[model samples]
Target: MSTIIEQNQSNIITDNGLFPSNEVMLDLKNLKKVYPTPKGDYVVLEDLNLQIRKEEFVTIIGHSGCGKTTMLSMIAGLNPISGGRISVLGKQIKGPGPDRGVIFQAPSLMPWMTALQNVLLGVNQVFPHATKAQRNDIAKYYLQKVGLEDAFNKRASDLSQGMQQRVGIARAFAIKPKVLLLDEPFGMLDSLTRGELQDILIEIWNKEKITAVMITHDVDEAIFLADRVVMMTSGPKAKIGDILDIEFERPRTRKSVLEHDDYYKYRKHLIDFLEH
Candidate 1:
């Protein structure tokens, strides 16, 4: 069985109605992915194993064509694993569920919908039992948290890319998902905007304690946001290369983190890994 212990270790029931437990939030055991091609089977990932504790922020980094995003897709139930298993809170993932929320490279907002409406769409679907006022409050609270309070009424087509991404982030969080899957969510943004969104994401993660798995190519961003930085080998058959535990204390700032000795050490290590 994937679950080591299924009993409730804590009495806290989250707003999403899940009883938080002292257990691994996500577990991937011997996970593999393969695609059949005209040439033959193309292996993307194999013999991969990883475990994330409850509320942990883990980032996967590698060059293009690595299976980092594929791993996230499997965990999100968007793709089927050809081998092994993925378990969330000890239960195997079957398909897309409200327990997992995803933010992609593009905001993917509805052009005709206002920012608030776009956010409300996901919130309502995930929380159909919630009162209208309650759902409205949830939408407003998350939008404000992402610094999009003033853009509530603006249509998605009218908003800047950064603002639209803010709406995407708000929509993802409003659902109160136990796990947040980010596939290069800020990859298309400029450095300044990406940094801003990174800080906002950190604040939300800190507040909500949602387990997060983000795939990124940016070393600095990975160090800044992740509890553990997981590097993957370049793939025809990719697997974890190394795992680096970030020791920076919570409420981390870019300036303070950049000044730390271990920060540079970890950076150099990651660079060396990617180089050879």
Candidate 2:
């Protein structure tokens, strides 16, 4: 049984032990992953366990080859788990579904299609029963939310990288997925562009309250975006080494966070883990 936790208004732990919420939106139980090599099986992750609550933002961070992306793939149903099980909202995750949406480092919009068309494609597939008007509305709303209302008709190839990624974000949210998976979604962007997209993502997340799991290498990004930062050890059989619950107040500004002592403490802790 999972232990219960008491949360203050700030979500800072004033008393009691560290425990995940009772309402688990996603559960990974003793999860394992192994790949068959020419010589033998190469295990990437073993005995991995984690529980995420509904609408919670969780980020996984570690050194390279730590299986962070691999773990995200498993959750996305893109890869098969060698052992253990993944449950999403009490349903077993056997394969991909409209319930989960993934955004990768690169914007995956089709070069042939316009931003509106690209977003509508996924929304249409996910909600096939909806009328054309409804689907159009859904796509446009998300696009507008991501600050791409004027660029709706722009082709993916014509748009800037950051703008293209905005379309991807719009497309993912248009599906109204229960869970959102992000794999270094801003890894290639400039610092200013990355910050802009991060703010957009945060705004969407706050409004939608969709459960999110992201894989990232940046400690500051993980700290700013995650409700909990899960640190993994190095692989060939990597597993979670630590889980740090972020105690920062919501509507968090970058300036405020940087000035806070707790932020540096959290940053230092994560950096130390990655270094040694």
TM-score of each: 0.91, 0.92
Candidate 1: stretches off by over 4 Å: 1-22
lDDT of 2 by residue, 28-102 (tens): 888999999999999999998887888789999999878999999999999999999998876789898878899
lDDT of 1 by residue, 1-276 (tens): 233244344554432333343466887888999999999999999999887878789999999998888899899999999999988887898998879999988999998999999999999998899999999999999999999888899999999999999999999999999899999999999999999999999988889989999999899999999999999999989999999989899988888899998998999989999998
Clashing residue pairs in all predictions, respectively, total: 0, 0
Error of 2 at 110 (Å): 0.9
Q: Name the top lDDT candidate.
A: 1
Candidate 1: which pairs clash? none
Q: List runs of model 2 lying over 4 Å from the truth.
A: 1-22
Q: Candidate 1: deviation at residue 66, Å?
A: 1.0
Candidate with best TM-score: 2
